[model samples]
Target chain A: MTYCVALKLDRGLVMMSDTRTNAGLDNISTFRKMHVWEKPGERVLTLMTAGNLATTQAVISILDERMKAPEEREPSIFAAPSMFQVARIVADTLREVIGRQADSGQKADAAFNATVLLGGQIAGGPVRLFLIYPEGNFIEASDDTPFFQIGETKYGRPILVRAFERTMSFEAAVKLLVVSFDSTIKANLSVGMPLDVALYEEGSLSLGTPWRMEANDAYYRTISEGWGDALKQAFDRLPDMELPTSG
Target chain B: MTYCVALKLDRGLVMMSDTRTNAGLDNISTFRKMHVWEKPGERVLTLMTAGNLATTQAVISILDERMKAPEEREPSIFAAPSMFQVARIVADTLREVIGRQADSGQKADAAFNATVLLGGQIAGGPVRLFLIYPEGNFIEASDDTPFFQIGETKYGRPILVRAFERTMSFEAAVKLLVVSFDSTIKANLSVGMPLDVALYEEGSLSLGTPWRMEANDAYYRTISEGWGDALKQAFDRLPDMELPTSG
Candidate 1:
């Protein structure tokens, strides 16, 4: 299991993904789930994947190879005219990989399914974020839903729903995502640290080098411990239930 | 879908369950998920269920009938020697009902599975709680794992993990549970009000009348709105992330 979240704030997009990948309880490994493509001031695209490791890696590898050899692969993400086109390419690739696995007599096609979170800007286009499903369909985040989370999402979702705002700074948004990720990591062993994070400033048309937050990272440690304490305090502040003595 | 949680605190047991029952998104009705059996000064047992409504209802009906006709049913929960025996009786009934459904040509046995949370005290026995599976196996809650939640559990679990303490008062535990349920109800439409709650104090050997928190209940509304504000304040209190501007 993986936990990847992308927030579309007014300032920009704040995205985070866990590094743990496991085939089973005993077969766990660290793998980067965030993939980014950039052509400086022209276009910037970030993709975070969750689901079967083989299928996601295949989708990423195909996209990466296309970027490296654009002449051979006609419809590379780099040359896509808009963010919508980039999403289409990613969705199609995901479906193609899973479809191949099923076509080869794999009894469970669902076993090969993968979900992707794609967010970035392409030159003149407005910043956009999309959640691409395992079925090759995708939906864009709007004002009503300004964030998308894939993999081990439920434990971390309530906090996001409660705290997120459109006008939050990039720094505040990243902090919020960290807290969300911490809650998920504590409840589920499948989503572990270190984390990979990417920040894209609106209209910059370029993404910074993604940050790697190791387990012992000072800030992550502070937020993880601090959030637990804050939660306890908040819980204590709630009005207590008064029991009736009769029964 | 449903959300039922039972905690074994030092004072006794605190349990809460939602009233939503649905065959599909469009077919929803309210049903009580919490059931209690008491012999006043002798024993008090409470059961909360989740999963297929048919299987759970069938299991509950059989248990209720056996208790009503103890002579014909030799192993009724009322005559059980200990909480362990009561758990076994409930687990066996659950397994029996599911097995019968599968035997009657139900293609998807998993669809008929039901899980139960049983907690109570019998005269000379210690206050105990058990999580009974559809397979007729059950595990008791202990100092280490003092609570059990069944159905739509993930969204509401983080706060419980952070706030639950064995020594907390029954009022505090119920307050914490309301917060948890509020988070779940906000995130999922399948689990909704009103809620059913039961409190069992050790040595009392009996449970008071269960509380029904209706959707319009003033206290429930206060906690629901207050929690959202408290969570936002908590999120703002966390240290903001510092980003490298050079990137």
Candidate 2:
């Protein structure tokens, strides 16, 4: 199981993903789920994946390999003219990989499915977020639905629905995502720490290094413990439930 | 679809459920999911249902009919000697109901399946809570677990996990459950308002009048809006996520 979330805000984009990957309770490993592509000052694209490790890694490897040798049949994400084109490249690559897996007598739609979250700025294009489905179709987030979460999403969703704001600062957005992730990590063991986070300021063409938070990172700890204490306090403040006079 | 939750606390039990039932998005209706049986100073038992409306309603109608005339093969739940026996009767009746549906060429395990949360106290037994499964098996809530949620549970679970206290006041428990249910209602259309809630005080031997919160109930509104605002305030107070000078 996995959890990856990305927000498209007025200021920019805030995206993060948990690092835990597991086939079962007995088998678990840490693997980075966020990928970055930067042509420094020219274009930057971030990709986050959740689903079968093999298929996602295969798609990433194929895209990365394409970048290494650009004179290929499929245009690399690096060469896409717009954010929409970049989404198309990623979706097509994901579909192609799943196709090969299906060709070998595998049920790629269910067992080997992988969904990707692509968000970034491409030169003149606006900062955008797209959720690419396992079927290769994709949907872009709009103001009404400014965020997208994949994998193990239900437990962490109510908080986001209650607190999200379009005009929140990049810093505030990151803080919100941290709280969301913390809630998910506590409710679900399949999503663990050592999170991969990337922030893309609107119009920043180049992707910079992202900060990774381990299990005990101070800021993450503050969000985790502080949010719990705050919730208790807030709970204490709610209007008391009155006993009914009769049924 | 449905959402029902039961908490076994030191003081007593607090249980609530949404009334929404649907075969699909287009086919939705309101149906009560909480049932209470109180024998004055003798005993009080509350049962909450979730899953197939047909199966759950059938189970309830059967139990009600049995109580109307206790000269039957299966003992009436009202005549059960202990909370454990109450659970057994409910589980067995539930299993039988599903079996009957299956015999009529229905898919009893999935489409017609139902889960029940039974909580109450009898003359000599301790206050107890049991989660009855579709197959007639049941599990009791312990000091550690102390709660059970059936149907559309994940969206409302994190708050329960974060704020639940075994020794809290009955009022506090109700407040917590209202918060949990409000969150579920906001995130899921299948779970809606006009919630039915039952609170049982230990040794009361009878349930007092339960409370039902409509969509615009004042206290429910306060908790719903207050919690959302309080969470936003808490999010604002959390330590800021510092952006690295380079990222």
Give the winner by lDDT: 1
- Model 2 lDDT per residue over A35-116, tens place: 9989877788889999989999999999999889988876888888998998998999899888788789765457788999
Residue-level lDDT tens digits of model 1 in A205-240: 878899899999999999999998988888788898
Q: Candidate 1's error at A147, in angstroms? A: 0.2
Chain B global fold similarity (TM-score) for predicted model 1 against the true chain B:
0.98
CA lDDT for candidate 2: 0.88
For candidate 1, give the lDDT of residue B63. Answer: 94
| Clashing residue pairs, backbone N/CA/C < 3 A, model 1 | none
The CA lDDT at B174 in model 1 is: 83
**lDDT (tens digit, per residue) of candidate 1 on B122-234:** 99989999999999999999899999999999999999999999999988888999999999999999999999999989999878989899999988888899898888888
Q: Where does candidate 2 clash, by residue pair?
A: A246-B209, A247-B209
Clashes of each: 0, 2
Q: For each candidate, what's the DockQ?
A: 0.72, 0.69
